[model samples]
Target: MIYKTDMKRWLDLVLSIIGLLLFLPIILIIMILIKLDSQGPVYFKQRRIGKNKKEFYILKFRTMRIDTPHDIPTNLLLNPDKYITRVGRFLRKSSLDEFPQIINILKGEMSIVGPRPALWNQYDLLEERDKYGANEVTPGLTGWAQINGRDELPIDVKAKLDGEYVKNISFAFDFKVFFFTIAKVLTSNGVKEGRSHSKSL
Candidate 1:
């Protein structure tokens, strides 16, 4: 565990710094579009659990319209498109909306490869995650579940994949996920579930 701790911290610092240097301009463009598309803040910050069960605010580009109902599930299940802005849908599809999370990674709140963070109402899923060993590492920007099925997969399936990633964490696997992530975003595969944001999991 100490190895993972030290390794992840070092990688997080190096990758985040590099990510920021490479993606800052993209972040700025997204921010400008977000402001043009909605009345809310350019960046959306949400609380997510991190390593050691600590909480940190995850930053993302604003992809939803202002006054979007709070009832919307953050997980993207049921009605993914209902709350998304005109530009937001494209951003989500391209996975560009998540570029800002590099900031989260830089801040030590996330990793480049790990389980996607769970939301507050996702307590039941969190319980399942804990049982499956998904909570063993810091959450990430992209991971096995994401590269495999993304928002299309059920919580149980994603949880299992997440746990698998934890048990088998390795640089090779991380590289695979990273490149696969690029492929997923390019094809726009599994960006949403059927007609909804995600299938409620």
Candidate 2:
């Protein structure tokens, strides 16, 4: 069992620390912008289901306004823009908002690459993840499903992809997914402007 995930956990730790250091300036700027663009804390914390179906708080830069929607996923909201802040859109598109989750990874609540954790209340997706055995592994910053179709993929499809990742977990596979994630972020591919399109990081 450890063969599948221990290496990944170490990698997640080292890389997340290094990445946080490298992106310190960028993170600071985003923090300032998020504060200036809206009224809220710099970081948004919400409960998510992690490895072994444990509930843990996932961290991200506050993208939505403070007035409403505490724990709801961005995609679930009918009027996502109503809650989304101005700077949030760009951050989401760039995938920079996810920088805060590096903290989660460092805390051992997440990995650098694995199935993205489901929201605490996403009962159906949680059930699907459990069925696929995806819940046995720590959720990650990016994963196989994210690079494949992202928001375009259905829950069942995403679960299957996560299952594939769990079965094939390795350095090479993680490297590939990491590269593809970067490419997608740069190109803004699979990023949704509306809440109905897909989930956010």
Could you say which candidate leads in lDDT?
A: 2
Q: In candidate 2, what are the lDDT values of residues 103-138, reduced to their tens digit?
A: 899999988889999888888888888887999988
Which residue window of length 10 is worst by lDDT in model 1?
192-201
Cα lDDT, all candidates: 0.76, 0.84
* RMSD (CA, Å), each prediction: 2.5, 1.6
Per-candidate clashes come to: 4, 0
> Per-prediction TM-score, please?
0.87, 0.94
In model 1, the clashing pairs are: 76-198, 77-198, 77-200, 80-197
Off by over 4 Å in 1: 1-3, 74-82, 193-201
Candidate 2 C-alpha error for residue 28, in Å = 1.0
Candidate 2: C-alpha lDDT: 0.84
